[model samples]
Target: MFKKLLSSIGIGSATVDTKLTKAQYVQGETVEGVVDIRGGNVEQHIDEIYLALVTTYIREIDDKKFEEKAVLARYKVSDSLTIGPNETKTIPFQFALPYDVPVTVGTSRVWLQTGLDIKMALDPQDRDYLAIEPHPLVEAFLEAVRQLGFRLRHVQCEQAPRYWQRRLPFVQEFEFKPVSGPFKGRLDELEAIFFVSEHGVEVILEIDRKARGFAGLLSEALDMDETLVRFTYGPSDVASLPQRLANAIGRHS
Candidate 1:
């Protein structure tokens, strides 16, 4: 109990605090935050202050499945800042967020956050997860999906592997509830994978079809067991994603 008690008493340790100006921000928007450093008993000189956006990436390596949390983006916030014993220093920074960012659950499902990485001399990297909000355009696109009768399933983020020549390490796939009613027996599941760039969002709809037992057996024998339909949604967007997806599949089929 005494050792545990002393661990919480600062006990010759240094700490840093990071605070963001806002919890919500849009893509291409500048994010403002402050890094406050508190020194302990002795003086210390920091080599550099850095911030990075970390994301998880899933891929298959050597026929084995694995997931990696990669540093998507990084920026140097400060070069050198010294602090005396028991001294405090505050440094403010502004950074532009990537146009394509993963949407995680937050306040009213509106806030977004990315992990921050800070490296100090002779200490473990000081990391922080800062929350942010979606941009208007991103929110609008999500609303369109909801309007199309698809419920949110889950969001999975992964980095595109070498096999994926897409030049993107991080990919966010948003799974949706299956289109029900008449379509319930037709399709297995639906997913909307968004690849956002500076210009707009690249929406890809993946439809998994449920096959009959006989047909399934035949396809499996032929080494083709599943059917996946892929399509792209563009800037001139449609209000209903399900309807649009149906049309796209129809035209392609």
Candidate 2:
């Protein structure tokens, strides 16, 4: 009775630990892992086991910025089970990583949160950080930008507009500045947003052009100094990205 009472209040409750097959993964890849549960002083009934892919994003409300954690995906690995005292159990699981999951860059992060649901008791939880690499086409696009002499300035995930929020509530934005090449003196900065799918990646570029003269200053004051360009790229277009991006920027600039 004492053990059950202690366990009910989480004093001697089961603990959970998750072990992933790998610590790093590319977006859209299958993630495989095992959840280990160790029982404590008394037997416990676990209602369910779940894994959640989570990350944080900044959102603004009434001019105040708030950082909120978002669940990118969730997977139920197991159903009901009874864990005996001091007994150990391992539950293996595999889930497809969401393509739109933010790549672990700058202040952005991704992690797997594992939890065991227990009735009338504190649930055991575990968190494991993951290094997420961009998809191949995304890698190619970023490389193309680098080749054009644009250096990565910042990266962040922010709340997306209603129209832009499809699978998740936020979108990851990559900011770049021209350090060399043709765009050095002509452009101010570039912001890129990627919408990735199984077929291709759609990129939205916000081209911020430098104010040139009195007219340019007036245009900037009127918020007319930025241009939005949208395009999509597939696997076959990898080799021509440099030239294509240059042409697009040139046309708008």
lDDT of 2: 0.94
Task: Give the alpha carbon lDDT tens digit for every residue of 82-156 in model 2.
Answer: 999999999999999999999999999999999999999988899999999999999999999999999999999
How does model 1 fare in lDDT?
0.58
* Model 2 TM-score on a 0 to 1 scale: 0.98
Model 2 misplaced stretches (Cα beyond 4 Å)? none
Residue-level lDDT for 26 in candidate 2: 93
List TM-score per model, in order.
0.74, 0.98
TM-score for model 1? 0.74
